[model samples]
Target: MGTLEDLTDALARDVIAAMDEIGDDRFFEKVSKLLLDMSPTTQEAYMTAIRVRLAERRARKYVEDALHAARAAKAKAPE
Candidate 1:
């Protein structure tokens, strides 16, 4: 429904602003509370999406870490 989509987008924007203001220490807490406030089906769907996003983040971080390590090794190698 349009109303549901509007509410979801509004909530996402507000939560993002709140997360920025609150900082990392409480960001997960804020999200967790948001999920807990939702219906079971909504919470499950949100959690699934969150998991996918987090996995993508981890994959990107792993690549970045590997590249950094390779650069460090190349810099330190015999030259």
Candidate 2:
């Protein structure tokens, strides 16, 4: 099985590819907004964990954004 780092790299690549395919500035803007909305304490905790170098915070951000989008899409879909 792949390690967490390997999985993170794969996810990051997927996110980048998805962004490239969509070619929409709003997609990124939405992600930025989400990041901004995160609590300062949460952000600080993430930064501290990432500073250890064992974790990839960027990958976490990508996954968080993707999950947010997925939830939004599901909410919008017909029940």
Candidate 3:
């Protein structure tokens, strides 16, 4: 990625970390609004990064839950 892309991704990571630290789920939306007044391109990139990261986290959770359920079922099943 180029400088802007790198910077945008870094900022996105910081935003996510801050949201988790502060216990405010809508923090990114507030950041997005601020970015709107600054640079539309950067704002879009930041939003995209946020969306992708959130999606990945959700997907990972789904996979982990499924695995746990499968292991539990196996343990309960008769040999």
Task: Tell how far residue 66 is off in model 2, in angstroms.
Answer: 0.3
Q: Record all residue pairs in model 2 with backbone atoms less than 3 Å apart, i.e. clashing.
A: none
**Candidate 3 C-alpha lDDT tens digits along 8-77:** 7898889989999999988999999999899999899989889988889889999999999999999999
- The window of 10 residues in a row where model 2 has the poorest summed lDDT is 45-54
Candidate 2 residue lDDT tens string, 7-56: 44444444455667998533533543454486554334433333433246
Candidate 1's C-alpha runs over 4 A off are 1-21, 24-38
Write the residue-wise lDDT of candidate 1 on 16-79 in tens digits: 5575686753464456567778666555544454455556767999999999999999999998
Q: Give the Å error, residue 13, model 3.
A: 1.3
In TM-score terms, which candidate is top?
3
Report lDDT (Cα) of residue 47, candidate 2. Answer: 35
As for model 2, its CA RMSD to the true structure in angstroms is 16.1
**Which ranges of candidate 2 are over 4 A from the true structure?**
1-55
Q: Which 10-residue span in candidate 1 carries the lowest summed lDDT?
A: 44-53
Model 3: CA > 4 A from native = none
lDDT of 3 at 10: 91
RMSD in order of candidates = 4.2, 16.1, 1.0
